[model samples]
Every structure is written in structure tokens, then in C-alpha cells.
Target: MWHGDRNGHGEGGGRGSAQGWCALALLHGKIEAHLERELQGAHGLSVREYSLLDVLSRQNSGEGGHLRMGEVAEAVVLSQSATTRLVTRLEDRGLLSRYLCATDRRGIYTDVTRAGLELLERARPTNDAALSEALDAAEGRPELASLVAVVRAL
Candidate 1:
């Protein structure tokens, strides 16, 4: 538990949750940067675009099976407007499609197009490989080794 010390440090022997949070943030940044470089170079897609495609591709066509813009935003960790813009960009690239919900005309659902699925399939390996490479590199660091192990366990 965090002691909530004045310097944001823990009072116990440990550095506390703040330090853990920083470590997690650092690991995330490293992994994201590695994935971004690999995905962008090999697939001509940004990390966000690839993530959007991956998220949308998992939706079912059955009743209430698709994600709304708000849900997509939550999944992608983006704002609602930002998710809409990302959807528009992918739609323009023929990677995604948006349509009105059958039961609720006011609701719009987004799905991955064939092109998006193909691209996602192609990029999946790259993303996985880059993530492994990042974790491997981070594992060598004393500060990140435990986090890397936790991630691998997960």
C-alpha cells in the first residue's frame, strides 16, 4: 500500500504504487513505440488505425452485436469525436464501414471491411513480434523485468 508520502514516495520499504505506475507507463510507452514503428513500416498503418481495425473486426453481425462510437472510443482509449474521425479515416481507406443500426436509426455501428480484415491479419504477426521483442528488451532492464514477467504471465 502507498503511504502517500510528500514526495510521492511510499513510506514502506517499497517505492509504492506511484513507482509501479511509472514503471507501467514506461513499459507501455516502450511497447507502443516499438509496435508503432513495426506496424507503420510494414503495414502502412498507424498503431491507432490498426487497433481500430482489430477492435471493429471482432464485432458480430447479430442483433446488438456491434459497438457504438462510445464503445469504440472506450476500447481505443480515444475521445468520442476522435473515434469518429478515426472511423472516417479508415472508412475512406476502404478498411471500415459505418451503418445505421436497424433497431435504432440514431445509433451508428462500425465494422471492419474485407480490406481491413486482410490488413489486420497481415499486421497481427508484426504486432505480436514487435511486442515480444519489446518485452524481451525490457526484461533486461532491472526496473522493467518484473513488469515484463507479469505481462508474460498474463
Candidate 2:
């Protein structure tokens, strides 16, 4: 199991030491790295880039699919400036469109284009398969699956 070893020093080690957190972080990092490569090779998109697309795809504004620049950053776990850069790249590719907020002039929204939605749909199988493979590697242990459940809930 991930929390700690069978000896009870598992999750974080006895009394919740940093080792457990480190272990968790390590597992997360490894899986993310693997998924990053898988997504990139198959779809020409990084995990983070695809994540931005996924977030926009879920938003709605009829044909617009708009989200505030800041909201986009939060949903994608990026700084606003970084989100802007990514959004610009998507804009260049016709995968997304950005516009000023109608009611609030200062608020800029980014929307997923039809092409972006299509790409995200195509990439989902690769994303899911890689994630499943990563989790399946932990299948013999229930604790790891529990952790996955917790993450999915979040």
C-alpha cells in the first residue's frame, strides 16, 4: 500500500513523517510523467495543454464556451500569465478563441473551438488508458486504489 509499508510505517511512516508525503508525491510525479509522454506522442499535446482544452470543453456559452482568464488559470492550475500564453498558442492553432468579457470589460474569456473539443475527445482514450495502466500497476493493493478514489473525488 502507498501510505506506509505493511510494517505500519506506510503512508507517511510512523506518526506521519515526511517520507509518506514524499512517497505520495513520487507516485504522483511518476504517473504524471508517464501520462505526459503518452499524451504527447499520441496526440501532439502535453498533459497540461490537454488539461486546458478539457477545462474549456466543459464550459458553456452556447457556441462560445467561455471562461474568464483567471478561472481558466485556476482550473488548469496555472498562473494567469501562463494561461494567457497557452491560450494564445491555442488561439493560433484555431483550437481556442479569446474575447473580452461582455459585461466586464477587463475580464477576458477563453473559449474552446470545435477543433479543440475534437482533439480533446480524441486524446481522452490515451489519457484514460495511460492513467489506467498507472493505477493498474497498483492493483494488488487496495490502499492505492483508495487513494485513487480520493483523488478522483477531488
Candidate 3:
């Protein structure tokens, strides 16, 4: 099994190799922080916020990607309560709206508003650029480059 250094990576290190565990942890943080800064500075959205919006964007909810609260949480990998608070925050900004499910009044769903979509679209480039730069930085290392490519796809 790999063991990563404190920085969370060992170049050319295999998964769970002796040298590292969480081999990409540091790199992931670096890329995520860059994207976070870009989105926050330009659009006032955090990475989690953008990820939630992106998840909704891919949903087939006819009304601008409406999704049940649980569904949204699952899709974005956020806790139920966390997603609730996040939805509230976005709702407050008019970026998202929550409504009772028409057929199941007990079920509440959150939908992305035009504002949310617009912001997400704008954040896309920033997200891409951050990921691209990080990957490019590791391009010269064969193993790292391969890992970067895999992560970029993910």
C-alpha cells in the first residue's frame, strides 16, 4: 500500500503505494482552491455552491433542473443539512428556488433559477482553467500526468 507524504503526493507513486496514501490529496486541494478563488472572486459562488449548481444543470428537471432535497444532496455529495443550508443561501441570492413537489406536497425540491444557470456558466471557464493549469504543471511526469488526465475526466 502506498503512503503519501504530508503534502499528499509522491510523483510516480502508485495508488496506496509505500510512499503515499491520498496520493492526490494535495494536488486536489491546490486545484480546488484555485477554482474556488476564481469562482468566488468573479461570481460570489463557492466551489460547493458551483458543484451543486452543476449537478442540477445535468438533471432533467423540466423546471430548470428542479430536484428533491435528498436528490440534490446525493448528487452533490453534500450532507442533507448542509445541502439545505446551501439551498437556503442560494435561494436568498435568488439563484435557486425551493418548492413543494406538486404531486407530493411533502417533498420539497430545489430548482436552479436563471441567475444560478448564468453564474454556473460563467464559473465553467474558471473551473476548467484551474484544472487545466494544475494538470499542465504535472505534464512532464508520466505517472502524474496520467493521473491528472484521469482526474480531469472525472
Candidate 4:
């Protein structure tokens, strides 16, 4: 059996290590699925879309506040091509817009539109609630309780 270590690292990079990784993946997947279902049902937004919107909404016109496409990809944990497609999808829905950077003509920055911001504002609570519910449920599971505790501690 794969018992977790006190430090949450599992035992010395052995079977416990693999089990720890699997447990972490399970925790993440469950939480993401819960968030997805809630966000989609309540706000017509996928987890990725909501995350992108949330990331973009934090941008400011002040220097270095606006993120380039690459930076956005990093922030949202998507590949550059995937991020571009996501941006395009949001743009089609009038949720986001892109413009060339004033300081660097070769650079492009994306911004969440008013519609996107409004939707994000509404979906934020749903996201938070779903995350909380998922973590609470996971905390009840032996395999996931430690991971959930770690996440909560973080």
C-alpha cells in the first residue's frame, strides 16, 4: 500500500512517490471536473475559458501589466497555439479583443471585453463554490485527503 509521508512527498522517490503523484493528479482532476461542471452549467463557461478571462482581467494598461500572448499562455498553462485558439474563441464571442502593443509593434496583447468581465464577475462565485465543494468532498477520501489538505494549506 502507498501511504503518504508527513511532508506530503511520499517515501524517498519509490512506490510511495508514484502513488503521491497519482493522488495529486486525482485531486486536480476531480476539482477541475467539478469546477467545469458548475461553471458550464451556471455560466456557459469552461474552466479554461474562465481561467483565461480571469487572467486577462488582471491586466492593466500600466507598463508590463498587459501580458503578451506567450506570457498569457504561461499564465494559463496552455501552449501558445492553444492559447491563440482560445483567444480567438473568446474574441468571436465578444469576450476578448487583441491589439498590437504600442511599445512593440510586433507584440500583441489581449484584453477581456466588457462582456467577458461581466461574465467573469458572475462566474467567480460559482467557481469558488465548486472548488470548495470539490475540496471538501476530496477531504473525505483517504487517497485524496492529504492532497486536499495541502491545497487548502497553500
Candidate 5:
């Protein structure tokens, strides 16, 4: 279990206090590290890059496999400028293409190219495995479950 013995301080002090917060931080860090390693080894993608590709590939509407840059940035918790830079990197790698949104000229849309989709598909297994491992580690632990539920709810 990720959390240690609940220092016997009842509801006001121990279990739900500093120790719990620390445990949650540690677990989140571990999961991110595992994901970073797996994605890099399996498909040469960082976790952020894989997430961007995933956001593009999972889009179900409009011209190409595309989504507005702002929407993608919001979905991936990135700043718009950061997303723009990331998109540029992907564009350079031939993983994706960008176009100005016709109706909203200032807006940019990003679409996954064949290479991007291929990389995302290739990375899926590793991502799934990392998630499974993290879930397994969290499942039997009450504190971890609570933390996971909170994050998921967000």
C-alpha cells in the first residue's frame, strides 16, 4: 500500500492529513515516471506528446482528424502557447499538420497525420500497461483509491 500506518489521530489529524497528501504526491510521481519511461521506449513519445496525439486521434468530427488548438490545450492542461510549440514540433516530425480555421481565422486546427496515428497506436499498449500497473497498485489501498477518485472526478 502506498500509505503507511495512519498515525492514530482520528479524523482531524493523521489519515487525511499531511501523510496522505505526501503519499498521493509520491504515487502520482511514480505513475508519471513509469508512463514517461514506457512511452519513450515503446514509441519515442513523451507522455505530453503522446497525450497530444491521443487528443487529435480521438477527435470524431470535422475535416481530417482535427481539433482546435485551444480545445486541445485545455484538454491536455497545457498553455495555448505551449500547445502551439508542441504542435510545431509534431508538424516538423511529420506526425501532424496544422491549418488555420476557416471560420475563425485566428484559430488553428491540428490533425494527426498517418505517422502520428501509427505512433499513437504503437504506444497504446505501453500506455495501457502503465495504467494497469498504477491501478493495481492503487486498488486495494483506501487512501490511493480516494486520491484517484478525486483526480478522476476533476
Candidate 6:
């Protein structure tokens, strides 16, 4: 049954209307599709996998690569269980490894392998290209910066 206004106005909707929800859904879908296509075509990684690798690469030190699994999950905006699954997949592909935390056996840590570092290096150019395209699309638009600031505020 159609409960919308006869004149297609907001006469029959709640605070959060269908149009507003649809706009948000479309925005999310576009971003996800863009990232997915770029990652799959340019690098053999998905957005989630790339995000995990990026976080670990930033955390890398001179000696060895190590980051807490929970911390990585939080940084990458994934659930701990989902992060574990991603880590498992990366490990199977010789990209990373996981181990128990020395300080606390109950805690787990992840380390990027040499292969992982190599993959990150390989994917850098493609990621840079994608980011450049996205930035160019947002060029001269203050809304881009405003959107970033708003997300960061959250």
C-alpha cells in the first residue's frame, strides 16, 4: 500500500523519510562499489584487506611488525571476529601471521610478513592512483573537507 502524499510531498512520512534513507544508502553503495572495483582490479585485495594492511604498515617498526589484533580491528573499523577472519585469509596467502601476545596470552597480535610488505608496496601505486582520482573528483569542494571533518568528529 502506498502511503505517500498524493502530491508526492512529505505528508505521510516520519522524521526519517524514505528519500533520506535512500540517499544515504546510495552514497554508501557508490563508495563501496568504487573501492571494491579499484581494489579488485588494481590490487588483489578488497577494501577491508587493504585497510588492514595499511594499518599494519603504518605501525611497522625497524625490528619486526607487530600490532594487537583488537587494536587493528578498531583502527580498521571491523569487528574483532571479522578481523580474525581477514587475518586468517591474509595468513593463508602468506601476507601476514598471527600469534599470542607475550604480555598477555589471552591477547593476540598480528605481524606483517615480508610477503605482506611486498604486497603493500605493489598495491601502493594503485591505491595512490585511486586516491588521486577521488581527490580530483572532490577538487575545489569544501564539502569534501567538511565531510571528512564530520566523520572524524564521530
Residues 82-141 of candidate 2 have per-residue lDDT tens digits of 988998988899999888888789978777888998999999999999988876665445
lDDT tens digits by residue: candidate 5, 1-154: 2444465565565756777888788778777888998889878889899999998888866565456777899988899999999989989999999878777899777889998998899899999898778766775677687777776577
> Per-residue lDDT for 1-154 in model 4, tens only?
7765676654566677788989999999999999999999999999999999999999988878999999999999999999999999999999999999887999999999999999999999999999999999999999999888889999
Estimate the Cα RMSD of every predicted model relative to the unseen true structure. Answer: 2.3, 6.0, 5.7, 5.0, 6.6, 6.5
Query: Given candidate 4, what's the lDDT at residue 38?
Result: 100
**Candidate 5 CA-lDDT value:** 0.82
Tens-place lDDT per residue, model 3, 102-122, is: 878998877789998998998
Off by over 4 Å in 6: 1-29, 60-66, 138-154
The RMSD (Cα, Å) of candidate 2 is 6.0
Please give the ranking of all candidate structures by TM-score, highest first, separated by commas: 4, 1, 2, 3, 5, 6
Clash counts for all predictions? 0, 6, 11, 0, 0, 0
lDDT of 1 by residue, 26-58 (tens): 999999999999999999998899899988988
User: At residue 9, what lDDT does model 6 achieve?
Assistant: 54
Please report, as a residue range, the 10-residue window in candidate 2 with the lowest summed lDDT: 138-147
lDDT for each of the candidates? 0.92, 0.81, 0.78, 0.94, 0.82, 0.74
Task: Tell me the TM-score of each prediction against the true structure.
Answer: 0.91, 0.78, 0.77, 0.91, 0.75, 0.67
Question: What stretches of model 3 exceed 4 Å from their correct place?
Answer: 1-20, 62-66, 140-143
Candidate 2, position 71, lDDT: 82
TM-score of 6: 0.67
Give the poorly placed runs of model 4, Cα more than 4 Å off.
1-11
lDDT of 4 at 113: 93
User: Which TM-score value belongs to model 5?
Assistant: 0.75
Give the CA lDDT, 0 to 100, for residue 126 in model 1: 99
